[model samples]
Target: MEMAWFVIVTVMLAMYVVLDGFDFGVGMVYPFVAHTEADRQTVRASIGPVWNANEVWLIAAGGVLFFAYPKAYAAGFSGFYLALILVLWLLIFRGLALELREQVDHVLWRQAWDTAFTTSSVLLAVVFGTALGNLIRGVPLNRDGYFFVPLWTDFQPGAAPGILDWFTMLLGLSCTVILAFHGANYLVMKTEGLLYQRTVSAARILGWMSAGYTVLTVIAVPLVQPSLALNFSRNPVVYLAPLIGVIALGYSLYFRIRGRDTSAFLASSVFIFLMLVSVMFGMYPNILVSTTDQALSLTVYNAATDSYGLTAGISWFVGGFLLILTYQIYLYSQFWGKTRADDAH
Candidate 1:
């Protein structure tokens, strides 16, 4: 039951990453993709209908964690309190920028919000990637299976390391680049005219950049957290996730060059999904690893809630998720084609 919930949580988070990542990527490159007011409006229209719904997955995943592993949820939330608050503000600003940019007629007003949208999205991607790095690289958990981390310390990866060590920063930058690539792919699929041309051209370069950084990060991972090496060593089959990620990445670029936006976009999404799958595989069973002490790692069994709670949680989750999935399908179907600046929200 615990393992099942872990899988559920992982899938939910992965969904958030893949679904929202392109939006973040799109926002990051908003200025570059748009030359006119209509171009910017069209870019906004492409994501306007779906961005909010995409974020619901993150909230759902957090709720599941709270129910399934209350202790870990508490510790993680408290330990990363400032970071979480920053993420919240980013989400808020991004949403407001999208809504208010259209509501105001003044050029300066819309531009201000546009800047907010792009800046917030880029920072959010970096923060999320860094957070994942911290999770994979482990924290300084003590004997009681709890730890607190400041923004940084000595810029190291060991027990008193800050949140922005060289390794975590690498992970953050990797995520940012790929998300920009992902966003470019999305724009190519959803827009027309000069915006499409620019996005397509940028996507190719960004795709290669994402792939290169991913390779560098893969090599750096073992050096930053050697324990992740133990997981790969134990389960040879787990390597398939990363392998698929590389293949999807290459396929995405090929499809993009061939002018198949839909295929390229799908491939980009798959690459992000598989990348997370590989990370989860490498850190299996351990929700939060310990850098301070090996014995303090938070494993599935150690951190799970009582059996009764998880069993009840699973039953409720299944029923609620089916409804959510149905609505999402209907919503996407309603807005399936290319978006124009004049399209209604």
Candidate 2:
């Protein structure tokens, strides 16, 4: 049951990344993509219908984690209290920026809100990417399963790890650029006329940025997680994820250049999926690892609830997921195709 719930939660988290990720990416690129008031409105209209819906996956993932892996949820939330608060603040401000940006007609008012949205979006993406890096790099979980990391300690990858380190920051940057390109591609695909042309140019620029940063991240991963390299050496199949990611990225570039919007966006989603799978596969059974002590590793089995509880949880989880899947399908079907300006408020 614990294993089932873990899989469910992981899938939910991945869904959030693939869905809400582009929205966050859109927010990050908003200021630059939308040069004028009309352009900004088009950008907002492109993401407005889907932004709030995308977040539902995150909420669902958290619910499952809290219910199924209560211990891990408690430990993780408590240990990462500061980071979580920042994430919450980013979400709040990002939402406010979206809702209140056009409420007033003044130049200063619009500019302030746009800046807030962009800054918060960038920060949110970095925090999320850093959080993922910490997961792969492992935390300083002691015997009590509690640890706190400040912004920086030594500014090195593994040397006295902190919330922001060389490795994690690079990963965060990669996430930022990748999402920026993804959002750009999305805007290009959805919007027409001048908005589409701007999106195409932005996509090209951010696409190059994404490609360069992704390469750096790929190189850094094995260097930062030497054990992962060792694991890949032992099991050559693990290399497939990165290989597939490279291929998908190439496809994205080709499709974007060819002006094939849907295919380009699809490739973007695939790239994110392959990259996430690569990280998860590298980390394997360990839910959390200790930077300070190797013995304090948190594995799925070790961190799970007991046998009977897990068994019952599995049944409930499966049922819930089927319903969730049905609803999601219906929702997407209802909102299929490109959103028009008339459709948006």
Q: TM-score of every model?
A: 0.98, 0.93
Tens-place lDDT digits, model 1, residues 1-345: 988988888888998999999999999989998989889989999998999989988998899899998878987997899999999999999999998887869989988999999999999999999999899889888787678888888877887878999999999999999999999999888899888898888898998999899899989998987778889889988888889888999999899989999999999999899889888878878889888777788877889999998998878999878877888889889988899999868
Residue 39, candidate 2: alpha-carbon lDDT: 79
Among all candidates shown, the one with the greatest lDDT:
1
As for candidate 1, its clashing pairs are 152-162, 153-162
Instruction: Estimate, for each residue in 203-273, the C-alpha lDDT of model 2 and write its tens digit.
Output: 98888889999889888888877776777777799889878988999899999999999899989988887
- Clashing pairs for model 2 are none
